[model samples]
Target: MPSVLWVSLFMWSYQKLASVYPRERPLLLLRVSGEVVEVDEKLSDLPGLVNTSPYEKGWLIKVKLSNSGELNSLMDDDKYSKFCEGNH
Candidate 1:
């Protein structure tokens, strides 16, 4: 039987949503703005893709935006990199 290892909570539009963590890694808190439309099933079986090909094969889910306005608050890749640098 399959057992859950960990669960994480994230906020979207002030609502809380629970996401399951199937691997042994740090929990990532993400601010999401949409409804999940698809999940990458291969990640459950091949967790290494998360490290080996995160930008390509390791994507976890696909979402359809619930509110396009939320895009206004997001950071671009360059800004996100700078933000992460400052935080670290």
Candidate 2:
């Protein structure tokens, strides 16, 4: 059931939001901001922001890295750029 529940990010996110609103609390640590920050609570009301204004008005959450070491595991601009180009 755990694996089955791991569906699309939209589904998973909506489910999480139902139980725990992202705007009410910190979802995760950014590893760059170095602080715990809240998501744009408004995202719950307007999920379309994801497709409309993904960069600016549609931002999901904010965080500061609690551990900079974890930064290495995430995609950087170049890697993400290549990934987008290759996949799409």
Candidate 3:
């Protein structure tokens, strides 16, 4: 069998119009659609997420981000690093 990357949301748009919409729980919202799997190292340059030069593309959602605010709550790169470091 082909080795799939095990993406949560397959070919989902980056930042969607709904992104601008107000959300209550971002993580919970993300799980609503597909399983909130591991986020990719690079962005797919898909339709939604305007594509930032992060790695390959600006991939935002591996799973569905139901609540708009959920995304907002996520920490920035620096904060995220801290979060990961603390957890590990």
Candidate 4:
């Protein structure tokens, strides 16, 4: 069944991750096991941090970016404002 296939894939992925990453740390330490983890150690107690500083200090993950150039497509504030203005 579809559910069985998904569960199998999930289990296989977890095992693969466990092997790839050191399991000495708790599996959910950062809600993941890896070399690069962004930790907002204060978020749980102050959930508004997500709204106040989403892209800056409040980021939930700190990934080792694979392609920095992908950011070129993102609009700057003026462009984003214009785009949003047109939508409303």
Judged by TM-score, which candidate is best?
1
In model 1, where do residues sit more than 4 Å from their true spots? 1-30
Model 2, 1-88: lDDT tens per residue?
Answer: 1111111122211113233343454243222324535556676777677557766666665544555554455555466567668867
lDDT of 1 by residue, 13-81 (tens): 222324335564334444545566676778677766755775677665666666656555656556666
**Candidate 2 worst ten-residue window by lDDT:** 1-10
Deviation from native of the Cα of residue 9 in model 2, angstroms: 9.8
Q: For each candidate in the order shown, give its overall lDDT on alpha carbons.
A: 0.50, 0.45, 0.37, 0.38
Better of 1 and 4 by TM-score: 1
Task: Give the Cα-based TM-score of candidate 3 against the true structure.
Answer: 0.28
Sorted on lDDT, best first, the list reads 1, 2, 4, 3
Q: Which 10 successive residues of model 3 have the least lDDT summed?
A: 1-10
Candidate achieving higher TM-score, 1 or 3: 1
Residues 21-58 of candidate 3 have per-residue lDDT tens digits of: 23322231321333555654333324333333332344
For 1-87, candidate 4 gives per-residue lDDT tens digits of: 111111111122112212112223323222222344354455556545545765554444354434445334445456656766887
| Model 2 stretches astray by more than 4 angstroms | 1-36
The model with the greatest lDDT is 1
Clashing pairs for model 1 are: none
Q: Per-residue lDDT for 11 in model 2?
A: 23
